[model samples]
Target: MGVYDKMGKVTKATRSRAEEIVDYVASKGYKLTRIWGMGSSGSEHPTGRALDFMITGPGLGMVVGNLIASYLWKNRKRLGVKWVIWDEHIRSTSPGKSGRWEDYRGASKHEDHVHVFFGTGAYVAPPVAGGGGGSAVKVVDLSQLIEAAERDTDRKQGGTTPGAADDVKIVEAALKAEGLLSARYARDGSFGSLTVKAYSKWQESKAGGSYRGKDSDGIPGRKSLERLGKRNGFKVRS
Candidate 1:
């Protein structure tokens, strides 16, 4: 089985995000590698919030005529996820900014995994300029985030506010970094109140590496992203 194939069970967020992503992919004639029917939403992308997808398949396009991987490749300017990692199938747009791509993962571990999720609110993100991988990778870890949500309803990750559509990657480059967690636990970057609580919890558990939380000012720094890049295995290039 592949990395994604081993995904124990799909979440509602991943499923919702995939629905929107697959629609656009179909235009390019690329087949979806995994149909995350049960995949729930996470902090990266909270429930009901759809987003671009991460490339889990071998390639976005290249098999046939319509298989021209150029669809995502050509529209690179609009999708930010590609700019951060450089994948075709796993594409995503900034939260709130519909149809606009920001690729915030940056040159971090998130560069490896695609975050098509919603809110969690709080995040720390990695420091890789132009890296869409922010501090919300934790959202993908549904189990951990779910526990945090029990305490708060809204996200604390600090983002464009609920139902705003403005997304924040809040990733670094890896999946293990707690700095990458999301309150709602998705990858779309919606950020809510609950996300904040999760981030604090993560901070308390950490030992060093200069822990920094989200700032509504919308300024992502470097030290904050250090672990972020390593998470996605992009530290070398980042």
Candidate 2:
């Protein structure tokens, strides 16, 4: 099976990275399932710069997850990874710095998948399977990488209060980021029925409840707002 076989629409750079990861995993004697690509969201996925590889069976363990995440983090520069989210932690290379794995409170929690986002204008040169003219390749052991990643501090979940027009706009942006709201929502810092409907849809989708339900109501409460803000990487303020 080819890497791009079932993968949806993504940019060439993202495809290149996905191909490399797929080949590497296969070479390590692992079976890869779905690799999702584009969706109608403000996230990198819609921009063709993100890919989600669903992990299953033995690959669902934290050790394996950390291994893959650590390998990508170690070679983020060459791999063009803007950030990586696996299990419930996130690591980003946008600021050219490395930090502890921070908690990611998205509805998915990415427990079933590994998400990778490529940096803007960054690309990973394709691997040469049998070519003889390349430099020595470093082999990263799964056990070693897992241990290293585990040593990092488990960062806390981040969020801010919501009580102003800016807060509403943040919520709107986050909803758009997750593909929950269409462009029609306008994100005009005004919370209208459209925003309520969109947010309620999102809530129902994540929490499996009705929009009018106490938990999924269109109102932007603390917990729901925090989840949306953290999931979409938005700055929520009071």
Candidate 3:
């Protein structure tokens, strides 16, 4: 059967971008079990600019949901995507800040579905400033980072000793850059629960179309850490 077979009856209308997203997913041989296009007042769904792919499958449903989210983020410009929310995380294609998967603390955690919003205008890339000489890229030790996180039971504000959480600070800064952690907690240098949760979300964003529960265990892994470092102008030494 085709992808439409899995989609239940849709009561409300949808925009072109939402339809394109469904077509793209179907082209990739993926199935979206259920979809809802209408919402109550003050929602984009009623205006046909938003849709919720109520995905249900084996495991946490994060596998297929992440695939859809990542695809939408990567080709957002062409797809006219405003933002994507799934599994308690949200990524926006905003003007200045794009591709930062922040922790979504909305009313709905969106643990079981992937929500997408489309913009009316064409996607515009943020202006990049000119620079002459490039500075040295910072390096973080993954081993030390994992060790600190493992022993970070206090989950407090700062570190006990000076520079004790330096490596963690580096990673936290990266996470903040990705919008996963807020600025208030970005430089605390503590691998606490919040930081762990943010890192776990980051881990879940990768691997194309696979569920990554083990990798998203809030522990730092080499491959995922390296990817983060590469994106944020840092080097990871394991």
Candidate 4:
């Protein structure tokens, strides 16, 4: 393909980054090759701003360095960036490149490419196995927590997070809601599979109710919430 060949699309925010990365590589005396490109903001693709780089000519991932990782690890604090895997089911922070990288082992498809995320760095790791609060005791803004619950994701794409919570927490809460013999809710607030399933169920249950939540794509919408308010003896507007 020509240089004009589309490697991938990206968020308008990353345009500078993408260009900088590409230019950085080109500056190294290498040619841009075809790489698997996903995420789109231009072509005006749906979803939020994102970049898709389809590097080719050379084998995939033949770049000089792990650009995304480098950015995350190096500038994590400066850029206010967070960490997720290149291709793993679970969303988590890298433990300084040597920690246990977690994911949804069975149903993950990030095998080919890594996903560097931005815009919403809202996932917190779940509390360790013990009852001790430790880092998990931190109070999360319920509003942000609900927003994470509303996101939908699957084999097609990674979940879009307005605000991400710990995948572990999401599982816990879903299980909590589900209780024994049922999947629990992700109390930690991370939107994992269990939470997604639970959210889907909640949305379905509310569809016909006077409280239609959001677009009901599983994201909590306003109507459903207002009804919840009324149930709690709070006034609800039509």
Model 3: per-residue lDDT, tens digit, 1-238?
4333333333212333444455556667775655666553337766656777766753326677887888778877765788899889899887786579889999998888788887765322111222565345577887788877776746455552334487887788667656577657776788888888888888887531122877688788888888777666577886
Model 2: lDDT of residue 167? 46
Model 2, runs deviating above 4 Å: 1-6, 40-42, 57-64, 96-98, 126-238
Q: After superposing candidate 3 on the true structure, give the runs of residues whose Cα lies further than 4 Å from its correct spot.
A: 1-134, 160-164, 207-211
TM-score of each: 0.26, 0.48, 0.42, 0.33
TM-score of 3: 0.42
- State which candidate, 3 or 4, has the greater lDDT: 3
Tens digit of lDDT per residue, candidate 4, span 95-155?
Answer: 4544345654544344544444444322112223425633323223445545565444432
| Clash number by candidate, in order | 97, 0, 0, 39
The ten-residue window of minimal lDDT in model 3 covers 122-131
**Mind giving the per-residue lDDT tens digits that candidate 1 earns over 1-238?**
4223433344433332333345456656665554322233443323433233345466642242122233433433332232212332233444454443344434433333443333333222333344475433222333222233333234444333332222233331122234334223544444344344334443433432434544211122243334334443233112
Candidate 2's residue-wise lDDT over 1-238, tens digit each?
Answer: 5435556777755665676576567667776766778873436777888887767655545555566677778778777778888888888776654666788887778887788888766353432233587543222222322222232113222121222334455555556545555544533555565666667777776532334576666655545555554444442333
The candidate that achieves the highest lDDT relative to the unseen native structure: 3
lDDT of all predictions: 0.36, 0.59, 0.67, 0.41
Root-mean-square deviation of Cα positions for candidate 2 versus the true structure, in angstroms: 21.1
Cα lDDT of candidate 3 equals 0.67
Which pairs clash inside model 3? none
